[model samples]
Target: MKLREWVEAGDDARLLVIIEAQDVLSVELLRRQLRDMGEVSCSEQQAGTWQLGLLAHSCGSLDVCLARVQGKVAALNRGRAAAPAELVETRLVSAAAASLACAPMIIGPFTLVSQDELECGPRQIRFDGGKAFGSGSHPSTRLAVTLLERTAAELVPARVLDIGCGSGVLSLISARLGARHTVGVDICPDSLAVARRNVERNNLSSRITIT
Candidate 1:
């Protein structure tokens, strides 16, 4: 069983801790221990998995959140250090953890994500199971979109490239924002799949090309 929990100390602060175990009792022990930090909740999931979520507080700004989490993780290292796992194997680091918090961004009539929506945005972009890649939830992408909205005419770059396009959410957003023409490329095929579905979901296949 694997248990994961997150706590936000501020608008953009995010802290996540996870415990992995083979037996239920061990998992329960860790869950109980972590619970003392803040509000605790657990939901039994399929395949004998239990998800534990936590909300905690510590003094700091959003800028310090990542550094603080890194410090905490470093403090926990105690000595030995293994290569960081790609996925959240037993820890989450530099992961697009926007779900750790969410901020509302007003797009047209409805609000797009403004703060940490990745932490709150649907796990799957429009429910494309295997799709994985860049999250529009990042502040960087959100801010870029805002800039694009205002200075697009003056800063009209002939071609736009997303170095690490994830689920194609941001790329599609560009198309939806009127880029004349756009193409989204991702190193991960799953992300490409997700982007394609997202395009179709928004019916933007005609505007944005996904590769």
Candidate 2:
């Protein structure tokens, strides 16, 4: 069934809509259209493609918003050269589903422990795993952590700046790896909020800054 039809058929109060866009322009277009209805998070899935996660409160509102967005995108595609935007997946979830989805696991040089895991062993990191993207589960986040480890090994006391630093995992890792300081920057307010929380949870607030 189509995405709108699927949403229209459901009674879920909260919905997660995952979208894929070939370029930043397309991603921004979708964000602009849906910004008023919900919170939008953007993360790069590959070199040129990006995945957008949008959390909306009501399925009825989403059904209507999506219809309007589809029409706008169609009109834009016909009049401009920007890439097309499309929804890839949708799911029904509770408010804390994102945090509940995160489980303790090892990622590169550090251990990612959920916030509930009180006793953090050596190299264990605690995070709330709120609505932010990085929970150390994604392959991209893992690779980034690994590369940071290798790079930090050669340069102790180095400062780091992480752009689009969802959940501030990389910044936290850099601080743990003996970086003098780290700054994390992200466009999504939800991501920045969670990243700040994680920074505090790990007691790395002195070494890391999120904005």
TM-score, cand. 2: 0.52
Q: Per-residue alpha-carbon lDDT of model 2 for 61-139, expressed as tens digits?
A: 5567666546755665675666666767765555546433222445676777665566877698886455566655466
What 10-residue stretch in candidate 1 is worst by lDDT?
85-94
Top-lDDT structure, candidate number: 2
Q: Model 1: how far is 37 from its true place, Å?
A: 22
What TM-score should be assigned to candidate 1?
0.40
Q: Any idea how many clashes model 1 has?
A: 15
lDDT of 1: 0.45
Return the lDDT, model 2, position 20: 77
CA RMSD per model (angstroms): 15.6, 7.1
Off by over 4 Å in 2: 1-103
Q: Estimate each model's TM-score.
A: 0.40, 0.52
**Between which residue pairs do clashes occur in model 2?**
none
Tens-place lDDT digits, model 1, residues 1-211 = 1123223232344444443333333333333444334333333334444444433333344335434433543444446353221112223222345343322223322233322223333322232212263333234655676866775564344345655666665665565555766778877876777677767765568867888
